[model samples]
Target: MQIPVNQKFRLLSMLGEHISMCIIGVPLMGLSLLTHGNWGFYFVLVLYLNKDFLNGRSPLKRLLNTQVQQTTDVPANEWQCFLRNTTLIIWPLEVLVVAINGRRRLGDYLANTHVANVSEDIGSWKKELAAYRVTSYTFYTLLATGLYLLLVHTLFDWLGF
Candidate 1:
């Protein structure tokens, strides 16, 4: 089935993903600070790589009832996942491609991946609520924020600014 990429669905997915990241990131920052920065980069890297861009159903996609799928009706594999995520890393280029092609970009074309709306109430509310609980987010945010501050401070101090 061809996936329809509705603008509203895309926007909702982005918002949900951002909120989820913030929920996880804050405590990650704090813990990184406590550990002297070693875990910070690792945390960020793991989160980015392991985040479900195709079938894992990222928080945003879950909220929007959307999912990324292969054009062929087959589930996405690891390489497809990596390529699809490249859009996040090189977003400007991806955007340029999408704009030039009228919304079809390299990642979509090459990976045979497209975003489609799934059935809206697929147990998503319970998952999101669990994710939203303050306790679940606190540790991650603290770790991420603390490490970010530490890095900023170190950079300024080194530059004598």
Candidate 2:
């Protein structure tokens, strides 16, 4: 299939990188359980709250050559990186968003960012990270976490768990 959005992030590439990142959670959860009991779930939760787009490219995404950038022509900021990743808790919806719309994912809209063509760079994330709003970030992060827990509980309920 053609790479969508003029060579932004193809569906398979995006999914592959995310799935690969999830793989790392296995060991994290195992270790966290041993040391932190049920808090292990929190340890593994970072699998969704991605910091890769802020600190550095995941080796996989770099190999795939996908870059996240702001739609407003500014380099992506720290909040965007975190908020964009948090939306992966609803990854199924995001997949549908991309596969049907042939456009940015749901998280991209939440963060006001997009996966840009390979030629585009997000610029110094280190510097961008320095610019953050603590109140808003914490508030939204809690909101995202609450939504995640609600979704999980709803799914388990629907399944009679």
Per-residue lDDT of model 2, residues 54-127, tens digit only: 43245565665556667764446555767777776678888888887676888888888776545335444455
Scored by Cα lDDT, where does model 2 land? 0.62
Error of 1 at 104 (Å): 5.2
> What lDDT tens digits, residue by residue, belong to model 1 across residues 63-132?
5666667776554544555456545556567656655554345667876876676667546545644654
State every prediction's TM-score relative to the real structure.
Answer: 0.57, 0.63
For candidate 2, list the clashing residue pairs, or say none: none
Clashes of each: 21, 0
lDDT of 1: 0.58
Alpha-carbon deviation at 7 in model 2, angstroms: 8.0
